[model samples]
Target: MTMAGTLYLIPNTLGPADAGAADPLRALIPDEVQAITAGLDCFIAENAKTTRAFLKLVALQHPLAKPLQEIQINELNVNTPEAMLPQLLQPLLEGRNAGLISEAGVPAVADPGANLVRLAHAQGIQVRPLVGPSSLLLAVMASGLNGQSFAFNGYLPVDAAQRGKQIKMLEERSRKEKQTQIFIETPYRNAALLETLANTCQPGTLICIATDLSLASESIVTRTAAVWKKQLAAGKAPDLHKRPTVFLFLGQ
Candidate 1:
């Protein structure tokens, strides 16, 4: 199964299937990777330790190689290669292949792997994205928001005053221009944020909260500010605050 040394970038989920399960490139696993990387030198990853932790969950006890723990995923050392020059190819140059993996979702899409991809491309190192889930796309799909015209604004300002002003402005803009503004906050603070949004935004504003997406306990609900107030006041807060969430400001 060893292929000398070739840099391979496998996405955790580019679309929606578990790549390690049914994909043709099953060697994406640590054991499989161990098999193929007998002579290889290192791996280029976001978090070498954490990535190994994930592979450990798959019960992949890589054997017959130097040791899975010793291989390096040189992402932690640098912020970004400054010049896109040949010198930065140190990780892949050590071997034929450097398996590129992001912390979550597809590499290079909304992650730091783009530089690696660009470097690989410049060197003709094959770059392929594997299949997995994406919270951003998943949110858009189930959001009832205009996916085509929407934008993922990542996280909003964390400062309470700034966050409130921005939400109100977004609510107004979404209403006036028919734009869907989607944003997220840490799960623990969901209730507080919800309170702010409910109280700050005008009544009848269409707001959607998508939480625990694709998991056992999932909730996707669209409600007006007024209606959400009533629902939450009635103790129907839902289980969103306990998990991750995506909030959408869809102007009416």
Candidate 2:
């Protein structure tokens, strides 16, 4: 019987590469993650290009024993066929450790990597999640909202009316159940989403906007709808345009 290799869940940095910066991997991503990542030559990633870029950064810290070209990266994305998922674990079945990486943050959380992870478990492969940054957890932690219970809604409806209705429903649920409602939007549409939130939610509803987390330009602010509206009126609100952000809401 062949021993199955462990499947490591590796976390990638949220921002672009900065070779000159101090601790470019950020504070939360520990040395252990880098060490573990260095050992794995096969990776299943959301995007092969970005994953290779991340590997290069890791190589900066720990030189790769094998040539960079030798490293195998299998791409996984939303449109990837479910039938092809098992192929991603072939390395593990062959007694070679494999890494699951996302474009940013932890894999399998908001990423399609979850499908592969689920298959790994069903195949009895060892699934190990390394310590790393998660935008969802970070936002909830800093939001000062109900961390005890929170829901990640991914992305709300794109239509204006539908989006407003969805926002109102989420707000109502948050208030009634005392749960934190978390969601995200395309970076470009962030400002519009904030506008919808301000219009749809009650004045006392608490909204947390966490953007560029773990980066030099990181910003995390929690304020009521009324307060945020006041800031908007004064042109003091942080611009979320083209910035990766996590939005959390809790009704007061």
Candidate 3:
């Protein structure tokens, strides 16, 4: 019987591609990661185009054994059923190492690749996660909140009322349990989410806004909800619309 190959979890940069000397985001990705990626020929990714683009970037540091076109790429998305995951890992069963790459940041953290990781563990396959940038942990590190006990609440409800209710619950939990609450929103709706957060959370609640992490336009700030509201009222707050951001809430 062929021994099952290792499953590698690969990470990608957080922002838009910029191939220049000043591309700070590129520096966040480790050299070892690119080397490992160059050796792998099979991959399961969130988006094929983005994955291919990243592979090309990896090629700059280490030459790939096969042509980009010849490499096997399996697309995985939020809608992909659990049953189809086994097919993605078929290469590993054949004694060929396969990689799981996310659209950005670490794979399976807030991405849709968790199912495959779970399956790998059940099958007793070796799962290795390489070092890389993670927006969630970065936000917590900069927030000055209770990093010792924090919970990542992916995306709250989109509806105004429901979202507000969810925010209250998160704040209550943070206050009572002394846990930091982390969440995110679609880039386009970042401004709206900020507005809702300022209005819904209590005046003493601490809110951290972390945007464009590891990029040239990176910004991280923590303030009370009251202070944030005052900034918005005075037009002093930075624009967050259409930018990738992570929000953290800590109640007093």
Candidate 4:
């Protein structure tokens, strides 16, 4: 019987394709991780095009085991059907090592690759996760909040009133549990979310907005809601529009 191949959870660069770096991977990805990524010829990715782009950068440091055109890539995203997971896993079951990649950061955290990772474990396949940048963890580390006990709340409501209620609810939970609440927003709505966070949360709540994590333009700021409100009032709010960010808060 053939040995089941291991499932490698590979991490993509945290920045965008054109993040103004000569080589984004060189700065963020460890040499060992890049070498492992270079050896894989089969991958399951959130976006095949973006995965190929990431692979191209990996090739800059270590030549790929197979040429880009010859490598096999399968797509797995939010819309991928549950029934399609087995088909995607077949090559691995048949002894072909495969990599799982997210559009950015590590796969299976906020990415849709979670289900596939679960299925891989159910199949008893060996799973190995490589070292990489995770924006959620980075934010928690920089927030000066409760990193020992923190929770990632993903994306919040988009509606203003509803979003406000949700922010209050999260703040309350943080206050009671002494936990840090971490979340994200659509790039275009980042400023709006910051505005709402400042307006809705209590005066003493600590709000940390970590933007462009691991990139040259990265910024991580932790301030109380009152201070944020003051900034908003004075029109001194940082420009967050159309930038990738992670928002976290811990209430007193």
Q: How high is each candidate's TM-score?
A: 0.70, 0.96, 0.96, 0.96
The sequence of per-residue lDDT tens digits that candidate 1 reaches over residues 1-252 is 322335565544222224354332243333344344344445566666655644443333334234556655566334656564344465456455556666655456556767766866776656655455566777878877777677667677889999988888888888877888888787788888887877777778878888876654667888888888887788877665557788887777
lDDT-best of 1 and 2: 2
Which residue pairs clash in candidate 3?
Answer: none
Instruction: In angstroms, give how far residue 236 of model 1 lies from its true place.
Output: 2.4
Whole-model alpha-carbon lDDT for candidate 3: 0.90
Give the alpha carbon lDDT tens digit for every residue of 102-200 in model 3. Answer: 999999999999989999898878999998899999999998999899999999998888898999999999999999999999999988888888998
Model 2 stretches with alpha carbons more than 4 Å out: 26-28
Better of 1 and 4 by lDDT: 4
Candidate 2: give its CA RMSD in angstroms.
1.3
- Where does candidate 1 have its weakest 10-residue lDDT segment? 13-22
Separately for all candidates shown, the number of backbone clashes (residues 3 or more apart, or on different chains) is: 13, 0, 0, 0
Candidate 4 local lDDT, 1-252, one digit each (tens):
889898999989887655445665776788999999899999999999999988988887799999999999999999999999999999999999999999999999999999999999999899999999998988888889998999988889878778888898999999999999999999999988888989888999999999999877999999999999999999999988888999999999
Worst 10 residues of 2 by lDDT: 20-29
How many residue pairs in model 4 have overlapping backbones? 0
* Candidate 2 local lDDT, residue 193: 88
Task: Compute the lDDT of residue 143 as modeled in candidate 4.
Answer: 83
What are the clashing pairs of model 4?
none
